[model samples]
Target: MTEYKFSDRAYTKMIFHAAKYPHLAINGVLLAEKGAKSNSVVIVDAIPLFHQCLYVTPMVEIALMQVDAYAERENLVIAGYYAACENFYDNTLDKVPAAKIADKIQENFKGACFAIIDNKLVTLEQEEVALKVFSCNDGGRWSKSNYSLQNSKSTLEAVSVLLKRGAMKDVVDFDNHLDNPKHDWTNELLNKDLKQIMAMY
Candidate 1:
């Protein structure tokens, strides 16, 4: 099985994106570099795409084009897609929103993965990763896949501290950028802050 390693930046940003809009469905893309090992994927960052009308194609297409360009510039690939279900209890593969997007990612990147935010584990008290990953098989089916965090315990602790500090508000998604171009969905500042914060934990 291919090993997917999620960085603290990618993991926390996805969680923050979902926490930023608890009642809404959120979706995003994962950017990654091929790991040193042949069957390993290193997910480095996440670009939050939308929280409104996930099924809309025009906006999704626009966001994807931009993300693809950005990934190219950064020497990364669109390795995966992630979604957070509006219904807190919906953590299954069938409940993943914008699933076709995941399929499209897989079409381009054979190692593409789909991750669903496990809402039950989204709390500050939660110690484990809140994401449940699935990989597309040769049969065109999504099956549960294993993933690891960069620094499991410290990552969880830092996220909890960030949540307590209400840092999630700093995470901007494509919808926010669309509403106001000044809102940077790339989250350069937040990414820097997260790295600094993680180091302290």
Candidate 2:
């Protein structure tokens, strides 16, 4: 039998839950924040397809079920696999308008899709803790974005100065080039970061 390891909050919670409601006892379940479409799992249940976990707990199960509810009312994003990724963003994804996206996904999932509306989907599992980021203080960016390879040194130096001063810490910038303007790496970074933060919450 293959053994699945529970590595995150969602996975562990799913394991605990399966013990109580064996019918709904999914071998494993991935989680995410409420409104986020990152498909990131805060906690994860690591159950092997034909194997089992070392141990289980009811308390943990309760917590796992509560992730979505908490994210709904609090500061987290929540969405399961199909809902988070494929079914999410109906217009952009499933092509359903924001108003009817839930219903559409539910239909798509054959009436078993889990979804939480309210847009606060980014902060479900935990409270927002103000990160004390050490970043570059580059108030002199955007101007240097047009720097070329011939002048990459000066442009890079400017950004380096910003980094030295602490600019990258104030806001998020996964794939943004403070000194380069030829790259449109926005969607990838934004989506990646969104998913990453959603799972952590």
TM-score of 2: 0.22
lDDT (Cα atoms) of all candidates against the true structure: 0.89, 0.25
Residues 107-177 of candidate 1 have per-residue lDDT tens digits of 98888889999999999775878999988888998998889999999899989988988888899999999
| Model 1 deviation from native, Cα RMSD in Å | 1.3
The most accurate candidate by TM-score is 1
| TM-scores of the candidates in the order shown | 0.96, 0.22
RMSD of each: 1.3, 22.1
lDDT of 2 by residue, 17-108 (tens): 22222222122223333333222223121111101221144433443345345444555432222111122222122221221322332232
Q: Flag regions of model 1 displaced more than 4 Å.
A: 34-38
lDDT of 2 at 80: 28
Candidate 1 contains a number of clashing pairs equal to 0
